[model samples]
Target: MQPDPSSLLQQALRELDYGQQPANLYDPIRYIMSLGGKRLRPLLTLLGGQLFTDELGPLVKPALATEVFHNFTLLHDDLMDQAPLRRGQPTVHEKWNANVAILSGDVMLVRAYELLFENVSLPLLPQVLRRFSQTAAEVCEGQQWDMNFETETTVTIPQYLDMIRLKTAVLLGFALELGATLAGASATDAEHLRQFGTDIGLAFQLRDDLLDVYGDAATFGKRVGGDIISDKKTFLLLTALAQATAAQQATLAQYLGQPILDAEAKVQAVRAIYDELHIRPQTEALINEYFQAALQHLERVAAPAARKQPLHHLALQLMDREN
Candidate 1:
């Protein structure tokens, strides 16, 4: 029987080891790792492998590797964004100084590689590492593109979609792909799982975009309408731009990027434009499209109905979230 993800991950985390050579470097690693997250990537990795192997005991190392690398990316991203909080607490850069956070984050990446090196089998190590390396670089590239879009006023919907694909979706894809590969699943089945994860990741990000503006403030964890205040060129904003009348476009240009404006007023005004353009419904349509595409791919995976049920259930839970 498949154990619940939370119990399995908790057990895995307790056993997961890190070096203690430099207290300063390792302290931050411990601090960040202790800050709880969903552990989705690692869970997916294990589940992906389980589609082939009933035991799933041997896949623990690579599953944790995905989680470690995921946290490493989040640590650096928090610094780069100057984010104040992560999981409702001070971010690494905020808690420590930027220099400490930078050094600590670098060590965390090295440690992630170390974990990979020590755990994976000799025969499969090279292929696993190669895929992981590519995913890491693409995540960085996606983050760079997101930063670029912050200042560039004319990002197309297609371009923004591609950015999210690289930034967010690929790792989810790699997580499932790695698990399947380790379990000796055929290349074809692995590819199907990868594509399914990618599509679901896309839908997940778009939901996040929607929530940034419309979510209940307490449930959302950040200020509501954050994307509007920052003018972050999300799917809603990009589509609004496409559908807006010339005068409405002028209104958007007037309110957005004005430093002197009140934050609440600016959010309300931009959201007003969004409502006029029917951006919310349009974005929902697109999100549902991706969600359906994900389900389609999940259907194509060559696993038995019972074996695939857990993944199918997890995908539904993710898609139905309001926060």
Candidate 2:
């Protein structure tokens, strides 16, 4: 069976609080951890660890490391994105200050290592640290690429996919692989687990693109049409650009770079064109293709079905979530 979100989330919150002090740093850490996210990274780590064995006790520390790394990214990302809010609350930078946010984020990164490096076997520590470092740098590279995309008018669909894969998906891949490694799974099995995560991450991002325009307002947390408002270069938009007629293309071009345009009207107009082009279904089909590919990679692993079943179910639930 899939894990319940409420109880699982609570457990993760409690885990986040263990062995922490210094109210300045710990307070912000506690606030952010308690704010609530999908906890997908940690959950994947736990599941990945389970592929080698059913016991979860020894896995919690490393699994928690995955979450710490995830939050470290979010902390810096909010600063970079100039995002005012996270989980419907003030972001660290917004609630405090940029310098404080940056320092706190650095501490979180250190804490991630503290948890990760503590119990890691000395022989394996070097490889684990290397993987973590590579993953962190790649995530930063992905973010830089994402920021670059904001100014570029002509990002190809393939390029966009690669960007998201590095920015969002690789971390998920790392979470799974790291857990598998900690559990002493064969390298081949760990590699397969990583591939599974990468594919699912791609699909998850594509589904997020679809949901930004089409999801129910209540479940979506933030505004449903923020992507359209921001004129983000999502798969749907890129595909629409590729498919639009000359007049439609011209219409879209006029609104994209202009500062004086009405946000809502542009959203509606672009959405109307997207509807006319059947973009929503096209995007959904693409998402499903990646999801199926993810499952295919998972199947390549030699582990028993029972060992992987929970993760399989979790993936399905994430794909089907209204939020």
Candidate 3:
């Protein structure tokens, strides 16, 4: 039997060399990469390329670039958010120091570019780099908007959607587009693949928000309601805020405004509000909307249906994940 795309990506990651001299700098990169999650972005890259061709060798290094870039973002994001854990291990900032995490994350970003430059064909390099650069900047912009939303009293759903699109979805888009483009997919098919990724990315993030509150603690891989405790402006919180009545609003404010409280109590109180507003169903509804949209775009891609099966199945699996 053939090794799966995920197995190929994982083996490549294991064999990756990030230099040995600067143990501190390189070790953290290795550590964070080893402490793994789904590796969804890079896998999408491989799948996108596979849609166009059976040869996945050329896609591996470039696909690895997506994972490197993603981990780089997580390293810095953990620092910025003061998150203690990632994938249930001590975050880079916690295991090392904030400075180490920051510098290591910077190196990972540069390394991601290096991987792309080394692997991608010269003919496609400029176009790939352009899209990657724009995606990187948009990710930063999205992060900025997310931080700003925390302080700003009024954040509309559209604004929140756009923020996630930039911060989370665009990178996913670029991963698929990169793979498709590198595999010689036509421009139209590549765009459709990008859109497919973007839509799936949106749904993925929203599902995360849903699971934070609703997922079982054992399988969820992290503490349920961590988002609520932190008061991160997720879709669930934002939607509940929008739909809440004057009384419900006051309750939400009282809980959210508290500087110090029992963590579980806060989660319970906030979760009650979410329950009252039927936020779970609403969030699921929107996730379904984006998911269905993703399928529509996938259908638009000009690949043979047989060739598209792996990606289609992967998308379904992503939507079904509990963690």
lDDT of 3 at 295: 96
Model 2 off-target regions past 4 Å? 1-23
Q: lDDT of each model, Cα atoms only?
A: 0.85, 0.83, 0.91
Kindly indicate the candidate among 1 and 3 with the higher lDDT: 3
Task: Give candidate 1 misplaced runs (Cα > 4 Å).
Answer: none
**Could you give candidate 3's per-residue lDDT for residues 172-220 as a string of tens digits?**
9999999999999999999999999999999998998889999888877
Pairs of colliding residues, candidate 3: none
The TM-score, computed over Cα atoms with residue i paired to residue i, of candidate 1 is 0.96
Whole-model alpha-carbon lDDT for candidate 2: 0.83
RMSD list, candidates in order: 1.4, 2.5, 1.5
Q: How far is candidate 1 from the true structure (C-alpha RMSD, Å)?
A: 1.4
RMSD of 2: 2.5
What is the Å distance of residue 186 in model 2 from its true position?
Answer: 1.2
